[model samples]
Target: MSIKDIDDIVVHDISKFRPQEDISLDSTKKKIVEKIKLQLKLNNTSIRKLAEKTGMKHPQILRVTSGENYNIETLIRILDALNLEILIKEKDKNSNDQLMNTAAL
Candidate 1:
């Protein structure tokens, strides 16, 4: 069964977890980098291991974890290696509300 929702409270749909109105690209990139580092530590995973899993070199992974500029494909590969995926959500102009394209990854 599905969980009950709180009255008068707006929440993101569990079936479609997404967000909109993201910050600037640079800021988002920085945030992603920070999150990756934290996830690595929390999961007790290391950059070297990630490098091996993604077929990337340790130095490149270091550059990514060190906050150096990286390409989007590289980011995707890194996250994929970590068993993570990125979601993209957009705002609906007609309804003036956020819409999540949670069809599938």
Candidate 2:
């Protein structure tokens, strides 16, 4: 069967599909950027000040936090300067099973 056939047959329940990984990643990235921006605002720090504090270029900081090209190492340094930690956790078993079922469709 063609992809269109699979798409038609598998979409029985719109809500059953788990978010695509890239969508989740983008959401996570946006959240991190917002947190970093908030931290800067709360501290009354400008991008230039943050750059000086983190030893990163101002343009690079702007680009990363603006959802352009993202660099994990640079983001880590910035987050460290802002005293933030990244967390990772696995989904509960039911959620995992649901996602698997959705993907197999």
Residue by residue across 14-100, what tens digits does model 2's lDDT show? 543556675456666788889999999999989899999999899989987798776789989998988888887986789757755
Q: Give the residue spans of candidate 2 off by over 4 A.
A: 1-19, 92-105
Q: What is the lDDT of residue 80 in candidate 1?
A: 88
Stretches > 4 Å off in candidate 1 = 1-23, 91-105
Clashes of each: 0, 0
The 10-residue segment of model 2 with minimum total lDDT is 10-19
- Give candidate 1's TM-score: 0.59
Please, what are the lDDT tens digits per residue for candidate 1 over residues 1-105? 335544546865543343343323445678788989988988899999889889998988888887787888888999988777898888346444222232222
Q: Which predicted model would earn the best TM-score?
A: 2
lDDT of each: 0.73, 0.81
- Alpha-carbon error at 45 in model 1, in Å? 1.1
Clashing residue pairs in candidate 2 (N, C-alpha, C atoms within 3 angstroms): none
